[model samples]
Target: MNKEALIALGLTLEQADKVIEGYGTTIPKSRFDEVNTSKKQLETDLASRDKQLEELKKVDAAGLQTKITELQQENAEAKTNYENDLKASQLSSAIKLALVGKVHDSDIATSLIDTALIELDTEGKVTKGLDEQLKTLQESKPFLFVPEKKEQKFKGWDPAGSNLDKDLPQDIGFNFAKEANSKGAPAEKALNPWGQ
Candidate 1:
């Protein structure tokens, strides 16, 4: 029976006992304390996890900064090495041109000669010296260092026209045709049996 019902009915111990005995049921105790304890433990665990995450973030940031410094050092060294190699190659080309009588200005060639002399020294500043030599060359012979032009080859199918068969050595044309045929190429129109 409910507490209000018991109060309203002015139930005696004997009457309550009779009702409960008939129902064969018992009242359960509250679990408020167990629930409160579990809540507190969960909050504590969350706070500890947040603190650990912050420490990990700091460690990661430090590692990233170290990596950046290392990469910057490597890049600087690589640039220095590349500049030195480029100066050496330019000096070599200049010397080759001078020896081949391709130089126009004696003074500019002399500057290259001096730079080459400096490069041969034990503590030579080849990079700086080469720059000075190039500047001198540019001022003295503005157009003498023009790039060499390449000759274009003839690409027509019949370089000698109707006399192509006769002009080309028999062995050369036959070998070329054989190679082309082996690679599944069609025979030249003039050489084909159908004359296509």
Candidate 2:
């Protein structure tokens, strides 16, 4: 309170000042042994906690770390094997599509396909040179060569020639007719691959 408020409450400013200064006092423990017992208990609890932490720090962690490393290595190995198997399956698919199984020996096809370099950077992509490799194999073993179809050349329209004097293809009511003996028949499949 201010000096005027203290005077209105019938107390001198000096007396009020003393009351405010004596807000709290020290504890008066009548028994000395009781205080000594509490202090000892607190000290013992602190010492036990410290000892527990020290014992925990003394454990052997190196063995556990070694086991973890071994497990990681094993996981990596299994992943590599799985990836290799998947690649083999993909190579086998390409070989089947190329008909190596039907025309050439499976042993040679398997060897070539196995060595084929598949996608190195991306997963699930076929080899870069797989088509060319199969082509090479086809050349070596001509039995599997599929000859490209040759386009037939049609004679242009002429008054005195094969076609009449008129436009073709785009002409309305235009009908094309094939001539006999224009193309030869395909050769029969040879039983022996080396003969062809």
Q: Which stretches of candidate 2 lie over 4 Å from their true place?
A: 1-60, 100-108, 118-127, 144-196
Question: Over the full model, what C-alpha lDDT does candidate 1 score relative to the true structure?
Answer: 0.61
Each candidate: RMSD: 16.6, 17.8
TM agreement with the true structure for every prediction: 0.26, 0.35
Candidate 1 steric clashes: 0
lDDT of 2 at 41: 97
Predicted structure 2, TM vs. truth? 0.35
Best by TM-score: 2
* Candidate 1 Cα misplacement greater than 4 A, ranges: 1-59, 101-196
Q: Which residue pairs clash in candidate 1? A: none
Model 2 residue pairs with clashes: none
